[model samples]
Target: MTLPWETLTGEPRTVELYLTTPAGLALSRSMFNSAVWKPAIRATGIPDDRHNGMHVLRHTYASVLLDAGESIKALSAYLGHADPGFTLRTYTHLLPASEDRTRRAIDKALSEDQAGDDVPPSLDGLDTA
Candidate 1:
């Protein structure tokens, strides 16, 4: 699966990240050095802080997606999680408070069915002793 960052780049190059250098096509951990990361961050007008970095952006994306009511299963697939359980455990707060609503709906349907079963028929002055 393609990474979200690759999609956001909006450019097709033979190399994935930096592209065409002695250091190969793909990005590496060393590519995130203070010189490379800090300047790019500064250019973006985001503050230079210890906690505010690329990883923080990833976490923000995950949290936002969860809060937006996306399904845990979908999120797990998106995040490449081995199991959906991790997604559920991480974002349990996003679950809907609909237990009461579900129960009420079921009860209402059952009540309607019971009422229909008791329907009475009208007779036009026809009686037999």
Candidate 2:
């Protein structure tokens, strides 16, 4: 993805592989450190002394996906986690609600089946004296 832009040198040029605004410009470490991170942290209302950063966004993304029933293996791959076990260990706290939902789904299915079993089989075109 190349876009026309002016470099800091004031030379007109095109940049590639950039996603953030000022479209063609890629994020520089200095830009992140000085411009982006502090403002985002302030906006989030997290104390500056506490832990908060892009990693928090990553964890939140994983947690939301897990709560929505996305597979752990898939999430691990998405997160670039080397092993599914690490992903599971990291996010195990998010799984219990999913397990409860699974249990409820299974119980509903079994109850529906039991209700069906209570119905007599249809007798069509039969004669009774």
Candidate 3:
């Protein structure tokens, strides 16, 4: 029931982690890239570059969280980064663009507010003035 991992020597081992071959060996990057990643991305007609590789999946995950207003600290933990600052440095560019935030802020500011609403502030507010 655990994620399978294989060492460079093709030794199967269990970690407190995340893939594996049908033989229960954790799928290696090379194996996955050749057997799965390459074919899938190629089918999608992407340029077949590293940017569209498996690494992009991590960025896509981070981007989703950031777009959803997840904090850097929270995203850092999810990304298993040692520090939130590293997460910021690595993924800050993926954050919602300032103009998008500005548009949302203005829309929100211009909207009528209902009294006695207990709505909590969204993290999107952090990205804007």
Clashes of each: 0, 0, 2
Q: For candidate 3, write residues 1-101 as lDDT tens digits.
A: 43335435664665632577878777788899989999999998988998888888889999999999899999999888888999999998989877978
1 versus 3: better TM-score goes to: 3
- For model 2, the stretches where C-alpha displacement exceeds 4 angstroms are 1-23, 28-34, 43-45, 117-129
Q: Please identify model 1 stretches exceeding 4 Å from their true place.
A: 1-24, 33-35, 42-47, 93-129
Candidate 3 wrong stretches, greater than 4 Å:
1-18, 97-129
As for lDDT, the candidate ahead, 1 or 2, is 2
- Better structure of 1 and 2 per TM-score: 2
Reference-based lDDT, each prediction:
0.66, 0.72, 0.79
lDDT of 2: 0.72
TM-score of 3: 0.60
Q: lDDT at 111 for candidate 2? A: 65
Tell how far residue 75 is off in model 3, in angstroms: 0.6
Instruction: Report the C-alpha lDDT of model 1 over 1-129, residue by residue, as the tens digit.
Output: 234344566555452454333555454545664546778888989898868776666567777887676778998888878789987897676665668868998786556556764744335221211
Q: Order the candidates by lDDT, highest first.
A: 3, 2, 1
Candidate that would win on TM-score: 2
Taking all chains together, each candidate's TM-score versus the true structure is: 0.46, 0.60, 0.60
- Tens-place lDDT per residue, model 2, 15-67, is 45544546546777557745788787888887665367555677889989987
